[model samples]
Target: MLANRVSKRLLVGLQPVFKTPHVLPSSYLSAQNARKFSISSKCYQEQSPEPSDGESSASKKKDEGSRYYVPSSQKRKPLSRVTIGSSTDNARFRRASDTIEFSSWKAGILFVTLGTGLYFFFRYQKEKMDLQRNEESNRGYGKPLIGGPFNLIDQDGNPFSSDNLLNKFSLVYFGFTHCPDICPDELDKMSACLDILKSKYNIDIQPIFITCDPARDSPEILKEYLYEFHKDIIGLTGPYEDIKNICKAYRVYFSTPPDLKPGQDYLVDHSIYFYLMDKDGEFIDALGRNYTEETMAEHIKNHVDAFVSKEIREKRKQGWFSFLY
Candidate 1:
């Protein structure tokens, strides 16, 4: 009985500690209410009905709670289909691109063509200017220092003087009919040159042969000798003093034996040059043994083409731009 009483006292002491069905704290109860409210809000949102087209948006807003509700101003709008450009705009853009491409192609061709044309034009102008300069350099100013008036008898025994040389170009050569090699060769070259000038350029030039050995080469002898080379060549012979004067005037050097016996075979030494005289009987140029027939013809042609009359030159000298002439 004493043991049972001790056990009963122990149970009574523990009962006070485990009493009133273990009531929870206020903080725990508030947390449980918040959890239940969140779960209910989620269920309401999920179970809400989609509004019909005839349903008023105001009524739908009124059914939602403040925590989940959104104002009309803050609501997101539905996405709309967007268009960039119209078909007409695309077609116009394509046309513009094609036009630009075509125009660029045409412009490139024009640029190349224009550049080539300009290049050739400038090149031609430069060449023409150079030719003009060359012509001017060859055609000197003022009267020539070489040829002058002289008198001599022709192969036909006709009286010819410097006046006969007017209105034509003349090539004068001082030689003797007794010349064995050099004179004949030079005469042949001159003949060929004359033929070329006449046939190719249609320019006429007079060829004259003056005798250094006047005593041996009489008018008849000269005629026969020159006819063997070219019918165009004219032979001239005169007195010894006249021959000496003519040679001195033309600046030709010639020598014959001082004292020669009659019937003595001798060769006269003379200068080898063909004097080119213009229409005015003035010296223009001199051709040596070295010049070829073709080259000599070309030189004569150039001189003829560049010829300016003495009257024209004197007229130009009176002009305001005389110095330039």
Candidate 2:
């Protein structure tokens, strides 16, 4: 009985101490409580019996239906991503795709461009060759075969023919004296070019004026009219039929006015140009209204220089062959 009383007294004292508020900080009290709970839970688990194999298998089957439990094969691995988005790379990828898909388009464009270039190149070469051939023919190597045989009368009542075209280069003008402005201006230009060639380059040129209106410009009338111009100018006039034939040979165009009286004042329309012929009466070239006196002189000088140089070269070749022989 005494021992029982002692035990009851000890429990009474411990209960008062357990009921008292803790003097430790909240973190320290929490740590102490968690340690006590962990020790109690460990002892309880140790005392409990292990489950049987059947119970363990049943629990595993129940876990299989759970959302958290997935098969190894179906489990997803964490994705390791590398960001490569930028303007330059995006453009590069787009270009590569376009090139691959549109390779035929690119090839077709290249083929067209190359074909066009080659066509133009060959055409240009052909035109250049044609021009060179024409130049060679005109320079007397081969005959252009223009300015055929003709017979006509001069302003001084003398016979004129294609034979007169030889011994010197001829500047032939085909027009009428009645052409008020254009004829006078062209004649003045011709006279000025002749003066320039004589004074500047010391080159002599023969200027011949052929009338398209031979009916109006008689020999005596032409002689009187030509007296007003340069002394070096030679005037020519002939019957209408003869003049027409000569103009046709020169490829010159002229047309009379509408039907009217025989002596009526009318303008004869004609193509205007100064025809330059070689000493052999072959067509060299024509000078249009565009040529100034000095410019025409220079052009003539160039032709003369080329002719002289060609002659010199031919003489040298002949001399060399003779010496070799």
Candidate 3:
């Protein structure tokens, strides 16, 4: 009975050991699961902390503020700073524009000045060329072919020569006092021309009347006849040979009826022209019937204005265009 009680006690102890193994395994698994759950809960609480009532509302407000916040780099600048920078840029732009405008204005002025200068220069050159052409056309080679020395007697019976024509402009008209109507009309026209030239241009010209019919036109008769036309007129009459020579020198053509008797009433046809001579007794031009008194005066005035002194003309002859001169 002692041996049976020892075995039964031994079996009871072994059975308890076997049951403890199963219970220990179940409890260990439960403890492990509980530890894992607690660790997960702690980690979750750390990651997302639960807030109290007041803290929760404050946190929500902070989150909302962060959602709408803008970085400092993207923020708008202050009004005063922006205005100052804008004004600086505007000033730079204005300065650039002013510089361009000034440059354009200066260029325009220069261009206009150059163009005007060129225009006047060309005009002056053209006028000079025209004057040269007129002078060349009027002059002959060497001395003039129309004027020369002559001796004659005036209406006062005083001696006169070609030297008397020097130092002044002279008009020589070859006609007779007994010329029916042509001589008187031509003298009247010449007188009118002289008056116009003197009154308008302040120019004085010597008037002379050389008689082609010296036999009929004596000194006294010639003087009286010329007084009716112009008081300043000087009548000239010489011997037949001298009158013929003077007429030939002046290129005047006159003809009386063939076989005409002396002191007979007959008409003498002569050239009707006023010969214009310069200050040096050089033949300048001839005025024909085609020229009116006013037109004649204007023509003479143009010649006077363009007149150059003999010394100046000689000096110009020595210039680069001496051949042309």
Kindly report which residue pairs in candidate 2 clash with one another.
none
Residues 225-302 of candidate 3 have per-residue lDDT tens digits of 999999889899999999888888888998778887766788778999998887878777888989988999998887
lDDT of candidate 3? 0.73
Per-residue accuracy of model 2 over 94-199 as CA lDDT, tens digit each: 4445442433677788888999999999996665545434434655444344466778788789998889887677899999988989888888888989898889
Question: Scored by Cα lDDT, where does model 2 land?
Answer: 0.68
Comparison by lDDT, 2 against 3, better one: 3
Candidate 2 residue 227 Cα shift, in angstroms, is 2.1
RMSD of each: 33.3, 31.6, 37.5
Cα deviation at 238, candidate 3, in Å, is 0.5
Which residue runs of candidate 2 sit more than 4 Å off their true CA positions? 1-135, 139-145, 308-325
**Which is the winner by TM-score between candidate 1 and candidate 3?**
3
Runs in model 1 with CA error above 4 Å? 1-144
- Please give each candidate's TM-score: 0.59, 0.53, 0.62
